[model samples]
Target: MSASVAASASARAEGGKPRGANYARHYWAFAAPAAAVVGAVIVFPWLFTLFMSVHDWKVTGTVSYVGLANYTHLFTDDRFQWAVLRTLYFTLFATLAPVVLGVIAAVCFAQKFPLRGLARTIFILPMMATPVAVSLVWTMMFHPQLGVLNYILTSIGLPPATWVYQANTVIPTLVMVETWQWTPLVMLIVLGGLASLPTDPYEAAVLDGANPWQTFRHITLPLLWPFILVAAVLRLIDALKAFDTIYVITGGGPGTSSETINILLYQTAFAYYDLGYGSAMVVVFFVLILLISMILLRVRTSR
Candidate 1:
């Protein structure tokens, strides 16, 4: 018995087998359910979409392999091209306006003022509301007639303008709604960044006889850039995926003038029942988003 015990100890002191190896099967058994769920819910649908994109799929018609026909057609389709352009245009303004405004608001809010807490709370109220509800309220305010915005304009001796009813003004009007709802969120992010910043830089600038504008331009802006970039990235992604607000407010109206790629895809798949073409659009959109995300992430890592 002592000899057997000594052999066991010698085995452990040498190259003994790992305990985790014995439980590897159990680990896999526990993880299998979650992996199966993800495969079923997420993986299967995307695979199906990819399959449909390569074929001429329709609800009432027979499916036939198209071999990149849909993708080729998209290049020549004027409406699809316009939708892509509009999506880019809308995304740019929507992302930019909020970041700029939010930065300004954050700077102002960081200073001590009377009722600062109350003001911040009120400012964030719009962000807490559902996007659908916010869009619905803005829809009423955007009415060409019987809208309070126009009423205010007229009362101030200015001409009442058609807000979302006209093609030229629809994108801008929608962007205004986006900026109003999301600027507060950006402000909160920046405010958090401001709170964590070291005081050494500001103190050094003060000793150098820097004026307010000079200090902010040279010191504050540089230090806050990373935070600002983060805010911009978040806003950019949100603006790219924006559909509910645009859908509820304008319904892609004014004769397809306000239609973005998402709206176009919805109309193609559901309205026209061209599942193949719609899937193609979806693939393109996914590529676009992936490319943008990669670029942003690269920038972030480089910085």
Candidate 2:
């Protein structure tokens, strides 16, 4: 009787194994569809782009394997090199200007003041506006002769300047638009950081007779560095990928002075119909962003 009972218990345990396997299979069956969607939507396009990058594919119905020719051409291409430099230049100013202004604004807003909520709401309105619409409005205001900006300048006893019409001033003008729209985002991030900072540091600073500036420089800034880095990373990425405002406002005009990598990529892929070369540019651009992100993340991690 004992032997028969042990055999029956072992048989039930063996039977449970198949039930567990079936449950796992059932889960995977449900997950497969979502995985397929991801592969179809995201993974496949990247693989396709990589495949096209190695070929001389054009919209003229010509396609041939070219290996690394397109990538090598980018190294020697003056226009491509200049577009990269222009992109970096625009990104630097766009990132720095907003971050600095945002920190100042955040500090100011953190203090108690009348109408603070109203001021903040008004300040962030630019960021809420659609980029294309904002660009259109700014374009109207950028007109050399008739724009309101120039009108204000002339009224202030200053000469009216060409905003985006000239090659030299085009990028800076675009950076101004970028800064205006995005500064509020940085401000919000920094403000949140300020709110969460421990009060112990301020109390200690007071005990040590430290002034507001000294306390902020010595304590607040160190504490806020991580938050600032987060804001900077976000701003840096957005600035690098800026297309709509630049496209809508300048359209890579004034003899390609304001043409960043994004504009150049668009023109190369769509206008010129050089899909292979454009794919190479896309890869390089992706790598550039990845490297910068890695570096910033390393800094954040180390800190």
Off by over 4 Å in 2: 1-36
Which pairs of residues clash in candidate 1, taking residues 3 or more apart in a chain or in different chains? none
Error of model 1, residue 173, in angstroms: 0.6
Residue 37 alpha-carbon offset, candidate 1, angstroms: 4.0
* lDDT (Cα) of model 1: 0.91
Pairs of residues at least 3 apart in sequence or in different chains that clash in candidate 2: none
Alpha-carbon TM-score of each model against the true structure? 0.85, 0.87
Across 1-303, the per-residue lDDT of candidate 2 in tens digits comes to: 999988877876979764455677678888899999999999999999999999999999999999999999999999999999999999999999999999999999999999999999999999999999999999999988889999999999999988899988899999999999999999999999999999998999999999999999999999999999999999999999999999999999889999999999999999999999999999999999989878999999997
Query: 302, model 2: CA deviation in Å?
Result: 3.4
Model 1's number of clashes is: 0
In order, candidate lDDTs are: 0.91, 0.95
Displacement of the residue 21 alpha carbon in candidate 1, Å: 14
